[model samples]
Target: MKRSLSLPGIAYGGDYNPEQWPEEVWAEDVRLMREAGVTLVSVGIFSWALLEPSEGVYDFSRMDRILDLLHANGIAADLATPTAAPPAWFFRAHPEALPVDRDGRTLSYGSRQTFCPSSPAYREAALRIARELARRYADHPAVVMWHVHNEYGCHNAECHCDTSAEAFRAWLRDRYTTLDALNEAWGTTFWSQRYHDWDEILPPRATGAVPNPTHRLDWRRFCSDALLALYTAERDVLREAAPLTPATTNFMVMHNFDALDYWRWAPELDIVSNDHYLRSTDPESEIDLALSADLVRSLAGGPWLLMEHSTGAVNWQPVNRAKRPGELRRNALAHVARGADGIAYFQWRAARAGAEQWHSAMLPHAGTDSQIWRDVVRLGADLKALSQVRGSAGTAEVAVVWDWNARWALELPSQPSEEVRYLDTVRSWYEPLWRSGVAVDFVRPDADLSAYRLVLAPALYLVDDAGAANLTGFAERGGTLVVGFHSGMVDENCHVRLGGYPGAFRAALGVRTDELFPLLPGETLGLTGEVPAGASATLWSERLRFEGAEVIAAYADGPLTGVPAVTRHGWGAGTAWYLATQPDAVTLAALLDRIRTEAGVEPVLDGIPEGVETARRRGQDADYLFLIDHGGRGAELRVPSGATELLTGERIEDGVLTLPPGEVAVVRHPR
Candidate 1:
């Protein structure tokens, strides 16, 4: 069930809003698209108001002309349903369709995604528009994929209104089946909050004290399902109209934005596509992009599409820094190396006005003679040369387990530390592998770990019995397991497991912690022994008593000095290592290097220095390795002498690859 466009080479180009400009501008857009080598363009994403002016009146003349023009120019269309934003008239007429925030304030319709997902009026109107668009573009020559509703849960993931409350109650009924079961799962006996009837439950609102953690967690899950239900209602209509056209919706799968469990959403999407934007201020933003791409690939179970990214300077960030001379090309190639079959930007041409007016584009407001334009043309040509790598997937020896449910649980109020974020801790573990040039895959806790030599779970705060058994079985079956601090303390309902910290994995991890001593801001703990000197634990630490596990590293000085800061337990054929504190970068790198050696996990490319990354895509006929040097400092790499270099078409008998800052090389070798 792999999904891709029929066109040749990596699909390029981005969102094209012909409705925003006059008909005269459409031709120039096509001509520039041809010059830029654009093979695909997503159209009509936010043109809901323009498409349908009134209740039953829709104007398709402009859309038809746009599709025809794109087809004439040899470009395919990922036609959008245009239901992301309801028309102002529709929202005004059906005011019940508006969403209410947690504080019980109705969200106005000026911004997009303001409709309630569970509102009957909104769903009906959205479906009507979707069906009309699907029927119109079903067999159109320009249409290749049906993009149903732009990024779900972007703004209105939760709505605390009567309609949503009814829908959430129904969703809970379907899950729990009865009130008794719901009470037991929620542990509602505490605080005299047990619900006698389904209607008594409510969405977690901002209260003087913390709301019930179970209720908040379930509400987040319900909101995700409600949005998914809306997506499916429109997707089914599209499938019925255009049975052959693949259906997808761009997902915003960034850190701290896991309201929707994409693992559940993946099966519904024919091609898992994602919208990724870099934090311009973060020096390691490239690492976040790679992690996001890897996650999207895992969700798709194969190659996915980079549906939306900025060429430079996105408007929403505090500091919208422009990309350097070669950074745009470097960024796109990074996604391609991570298994993105298509590289696309948010818009083909810069918007003259609106919220994203300052957002950079392929053809910026400076017209076709800009550095951005040149970079776009060069990337198109480079993608054409590297087309053979399409449909190939990157393989990894390490798997990092992620649970959106746990993330939801962690974000609830009243945690020990304000700095303990699920994604940040996960990235802390991933940085070591990334710096070592080892490719890693993100997986669910229940995913099969047989294919991986090492599995790392960093802040899995919520773990069910099955999750615990899975990790135990993996370690017992000869795979090294690394568990981070503040993990395994709660069950599915966010209830404490009671016996000790890290409740379920206590036996498997062979350690017990009686106290959690979270460090205050600007606080640090000294570490000594086998660990690196001057290395200190920051953010968090635990007082531990090892059970058959050896103390690898102990705190040199702190409230919990001489306690085991790190422990290793041999369970059957493998070992389980626990890090009771957030170690410094140097300590983490050393610990990961030791584990990588013990597990026999090797890097994709050896001797690759910092700022140089490598990813391999295995095809049936040959294997291609993509090496990217993000840093300006040059590095030399050894490669197959007789391999074909795709970028330069140079088949050298003695190739010694050298990359000088911001250079990318794709080498193809015979299988």
Candidate 2:
């Protein structure tokens, strides 16, 4: 039952929608797919309208033919349930199926994922399609895996409709059981908002007054749960019908539009797959991409799928700038470097019409003569050549704790400052690690920390008593722990831990916060003690008192200049470090450098160039080292003397390796 990629090497094609083209075009498309070394194609996504034009009617004739053609061409199929976008007729028949936004306005049918997760009608329809697809393609030679509804809750994660309100109430009842418990947990006595009955509760809609923080927190949890329920319903049907074919729903990793707790969903899936789209705003899109891939691999506990990414410019961004000459290849290899079993795009051919017509694909609208097509073909060949990477697992000695609950709690109406964004701050802290070539795995706060040498909780603002004990246990058991500012400040209910700031972690961290002095947008305080001479603190600062911990760095020049900015405490057999303010990049990197050195955490590869990224994939007998040069310059890299470069089959006995600009190399070292 080790569920994994069914294909031999990295499954290299992408979303192939043959139904959109004429019947005559399919054969040529298949021919081109073969030429491009397409091992797998995800078919039938968003094809519900064509499959079942009316209620209880499914014509799989064309779908069957497409599968047969793919089979004939020796290409595997990742068959989708086509439930992402239900037919327009189904919406006309059951208008209640539509989702309502925060303002309580019903979203129309024309867009994808328009259905409300809590709507019984929508669930019934989605399940029917899932069951049908499972039944028909269970034993098909071409179908290797079942792709569940595309990007669950991408657009409709939260709804303010009556159905959702009722669902939220039911969820709350299940969680709290009694009105007394609910009232206590929500702190309803604060604003005379105590609930005597479940019927009084409503979804947090757009209103002049801010909703209860606990209420909003629970609502976000419920919304994620409701969507997960829909995905589970479909997944169960597919599991029952096609037990052998692994089922997966493509997750939009760290996508702002959806808030589904992937940790909860990971257990239900046989294999984890994710759709990662690079943000245009991020200058370090490569690092962000690697972070997301590592997260998906961690969720699977093994290699996962890069189910969807753009080949070039995506249509959704405000300014859709096409990727430069070698960018696509770099992006694809980056995912593979992390631990992607498959390298796929959002689409095969560019759409001719509709909302995503301009979204770049493996094959553009200009046909196979373009540079994008040439890159696609080259990537496919490269993957085929480096097939040894399949089934390899990415190894990381450091784990960063991530929690959707903390994210929701941090974004609540009342907090320290609007500048403290959760994931952004986490990535900012992670940037130094990534730059230093450290492999990272994102884990839950409650996840077992014994596997990691060091654990960093970046803005883990919300935690339960159990979570607090978990981190403390990690430190006591000889694991180095780093707690950022604002962490452990509140409980699961968004209530302050009143004895002092950073209440839950106080005993473990051996530090107490007196007061929080949040800096303005452009303000910064210079550092003096323990830290590099002239290092500055920005965004936030806390006047901290060392209960038992030794001061690491102290603020140099401000109202709290004499106080400690950073502190480290030696507990049991391990040490715990705390940052009382947001450190600048140089300081953060310097801090991590010390931590890394102390924890005995070494980079995957030594002497890696500044802009070159390195990731190691471990196999039974050897390891594959992936080096990607995003610096646009060539560099000489050191490798194991006897290792062989897989892509070029060159022996590196001298241990000196050269990487060209925008190129990639995978070196295999025998264990």
Candidate 1, 311-351: lDDT as tens digits: 88888877889997688998999999988899999899898
lDDT of 1 at 229: 91
Model 1's alpha-carbon lDDT is 0.88
The segments of candidate 2 whose C-alpha lies over 4 angstroms from its true place after superposition are none
- What are the TM-scores, per candidate, against the unseen true structure? 0.99, 0.98
The TM-score of candidate 2 is 0.98
